[model samples]
Target: MMNWNMTMKRNKLTVLIPPTPDNVNASEWWPVKSDVNWIETVYSDNKPAPSKLQGVDVFIGTDFTYEMAKFADKLKAILIPAAGYERIIADALPNGAVVANASHHEAPIAEWVMMVAVALDHKLLQSHKTFVTGLWDHWPGRYGPYRELFNRTFGIIGFGAIGRRVAKLAKAYDMEVIASGRSNNHSQIAQSLGVKYCWGKQGMKEVLSRSDFLLVATPLIPSTLNLIDEQALASMKKTSYLINPARGNIVNEYALYQALKEKKIAGAAIDTWYKYPTEETDQPRPSTHPFWELDNIIMTPHHSGGTDGTRNRRAQTVAENIDRLTSGQPLINVIDF
Candidate 1:
C-alpha cells in the first residue's frame, strides 16, 4: 500500500530550471496557458535547482535531482520535459516523490533522422555546397553520386521509442527496415512496429554487416559506450552510411573519423557530438572534431530534434501530467528503477 499526501500547494505551470531547448521551448512549453508559472534556468549562475523548491508540489522541468537532494521534503511530483532523465540524479530522489518521463519526446529527434537520411541519400548538402563554391553550372559524379532510399537495407540500433519511430518512417520511404534492440525486452514491440528484431551482441554484428544505412539511436549506457568502433565498422559494407541522431559517445568519434577517411563506409551524418555548446551557444563546433574537415561526414549542431514544434509537445505532456498528478493515475512515462 502507498500513502499519498496533498498538503503541498499546487502550481499551474511547469518550472524550467535551465529552460528546455528552443525546439522544445518555442514548440510548446513557454507558449502554454497563461496561468502557469515556469521558472526559467536554475544553473546559469552556478546555482542548483533546489534553491526554489520550497512549497512547490509539482516540478515540471529538467535536472531536478541536485535540487531534489537539497529540497526533497516539499516535492510531490517531478515531471521532466526530456525523454531521457539521465541528467537527473534518479537514485537520490526522495522516497515520497513521484516521477513522470516524456517518452514521445523522441518524435522530433527521430523525425530529424529521416530528414538527414533524405539529405544524404539525395546528396543535397554536398551538391548545394559544390554549387555555391562556383560549380553551379555543371554537377559531377553521376548527379551527386547519389543513392535512393528505395530497396535500401536500413538498420536501426536500439528499437526503443526513437529507433522504432525511425523504422516506421523508413518504411514510408520504401526502405527494408530491420532493427536490433535490447535483448528480450522489445522484440514484440519491434515486430509490432513492422521491424525484424534481433537481440544482443550477435544481433548488432548481423545488422551492421547487412545494413545499407545504419542509424544509431541507442542511449549512452556502460554497455553501449563506444558500441560502434573499429571492429564494428570493419564489419560494415564499405558502401553503407551511418546516421547518429542519438548520443555522441555511443560511437567512438575517432574510430568513425578514421573509418570515413579510409572510406571504410560510404559516409555518416552525425548530429550529436563529443562536446556541446558551453555557456555560450553561438559558436560553431570545435576544430578538434574530425567530421568538420571531412566532406563525407555531415555534422549538425546537435539540432536533430530542434524543429519549432517540440515545445508544444512538451507543454502538453506537462499539462496532462499535471492533470493526472491529482487523479492518482499511473503516469504515462515513468522511468522505473
Candidate 2:
C-alpha cells in the first residue's frame, strides 16, 4: 500500500480547477467536494484569468500564460496534467513556485511507435490495400520486399521519458538502440537499457544515418522548432522510416510532405499535426500540405497516448502530488523551480 501523508495542511489548502468544455468534465476527473477545499473556477474556458488566480496556492491545468503569471502572487506550484508544458513560461513563473508536469503517456506511446514502425517496415498498409483492391492474386511480388525489425537499428531523438520507453520497446524486438539528448548524465541509464548514448549534432547525424526507424519524441521549444527540416531529412537513410509522436511543429510540415512525396525516406508515421481544429465542429485538416494523398505515410489523430491506463496513472500522479504539497513535502515531476 502507498503511504499517503494526508495528515498535513488538508484544511487550509485551496485547489483551483479551471472550467473546461462539455467534452471534458473536470469534476469527473478531479477530486470531489470534501473537507479539503476544492475550488472550481472558470477562466477563459481553457486559460485561467489573472483575477481568478489571486490567493490560490496551487494551480492545476495546462494553459498558464506569461500574463497569468503576474496575478499568481500566492501561487506556490503549478501542476500540469500531462508531460508537455512548453506553453507555460518557466522563467516567468513566480519565485519560490515550482513547475511540474505528469505523464503515464510514455508506455502507451512507445507501444504505438513500435507498432507503426513495424507496420511501415513490413508495408502492412500497402499490402492490405493490395488485397482489398483484388490485386493479391495477380501480383505475387507486390509485398515481396518487406523488412523486419530484428537486428535493425532504431534511433531516438530527445532521450527523455518517452524516448527512453521507446528504446526499451525497440530492444524487445532485438533492435540496436541509439539516442541523442542535451544531457549526458543518462549514460548509465542508456547502458542499462542497451542504448548507445549520443550527444550534439554529429551524434544526431550518426543515429539518423544508421537507424532503420527514427523516432522524434522531443519537447517542442524554440531550438527544436523545425528540428527535422530539409537538411536533417536529407541526412537520413533512404530506406529508413520516420516516426513522430511528438509535437507537430518539431518536424516542418512542408519539408515532411516533400520528403515523403519524393521518397526521400521510405515513409513516415505522424500522430501529431501542424494544424488543429479551433472549435470542435470546425473539422479543420491536420496539415496544409496534401499528405493524405501519400500512400507510404501513416497518419493518426494524436491519440497514441490516450489509453485508459495512461489516464488512470496520470490521475494517480496528480492526486499524490497534491497530497505531497499539502503535507509540506517535495513534489513529484518538478520540471522547474
Candidate 3:
C-alpha cells in the first residue's frame, strides 16, 4: 500500500490524460524515478510529436482522440487505464498493440456486486430506513422479511472472470449459483464451483425466474445491449432483487427505472455509468440521469472496483507487459481483436 507518488518516483510513466486522477497532486506521477520516463499530462493542446516516441513503452490515456497510433509505432502496448475498453480506439490502434482490459480494477467491482446481493437478500434498504424513522414496521411477521442466502438461488448473467468470482463467493454463502454467458463454458466453471447449469436464452429466462438474487453481468455488445429490458425484468420474480456491476449501458436505465417505479421487481443496486462527466469543465452529471430520483435504486459513482491498491496493481501489470515486449516475449492478457 505504498503511495503511487513515492513508488512512481523511481519509475517515470508518461500518462496522457485529458483529465487526470482526481486524488493526489498531478505532479506526483512525474519525478518518480531518475531513469523512469513516466511523465505525462492530459494532451489538451498541440499533438504529441509522432517522430519522438521511440522510448515510450506503455501508453496510458483516456481515449485515443489524440491520434494515438502516431505515438504508438514504438509503443510496446496501449493500456486503456479505464476498465471498459469496448468503446475505446475503434479505428486505428497501431499494429500489435496488445489490448488488456483493466483486470486489476475488477476486485473492488466484484465486491460491490456481493455487497448488493447480500443487502437485497437481507432487505436492508427498506428495513433499515424504517429502523431510523420510528415507523415501527410489520412485515406480516414473515420469518424472512429479510431472506437468507442459506438455501436461495443466485444467478449471474456473465461467466467472465468477474462473474466466476461472484459465483464462488455466492456458493460460499450456501447459495445455489448459476450463470449464463457467451457459451456453456460458464456453466462448466459453475459446475466445478458447485454451481448448476443455466445457459442460452430460454435457460437464462428460467435462471432469471428461479433466482432469488439476479445479477446482470453480461458485456454491452451488439447482442447484449438492452438484453435485460422489459421482458427480462418481467421474467424475474417480484420477490427477487437485481445487482448490476457491469456497464451501465448494458442495462437500459429507463426500463430499470420503470420496473422500480411500478414495483415490478424488488430493488436494484447499480454501478457503472451510462453517461460520465465529459469535457474539461468539471460539470456535474446532468440532472436528467434516471437514477437520481429513484429511492429503490442504489447508485454508486462507478467505484465498485475502485480500491486504494488499484493503481499499483494496474501499474504492475503494465510494467510486466512492457518488460515482456522489450524482451521480445509474448504478452499476457492480450485480446485477440
The candidate maximizing TM-score is 2
What are the lDDT figures for the candidates, one per model? 0.73, 0.83, 0.68
RMSD of each: 4.9, 4.2, 6.4
Ranking by TM-score: 2, 1, 3
Total backbone clashes of candidate 1, pairs 3 or more residues apart or in separate chains: 8
Assess the local accuracy of residue 306 in candidate 1 as a C-alpha lDDT between 0 and 100. 65
Number of clashing pairs, model 2? 0
Which runs in model 3 stand beyond 4 Å of their true positions?
Answer: 1-36, 43-57, 70-76, 138-144, 279-283, 286-289
Query: Which lDDT tens digits does candidate 3 get at residues 256-292?
Result: 8889888898888878667666545665663245567
TM-score of each model, paired residue for residue: 0.81, 0.87, 0.79
Best by lDDT: 2
lDDT of 1 by residue, 22-46 (tens): 5665325434333445566546423
Question: Which of candidates 1 and 2 reaches a greater lDDT?
Answer: 2
lDDT of 1: 0.73
Of models 1 and 3, which has the larger TM-score? 1
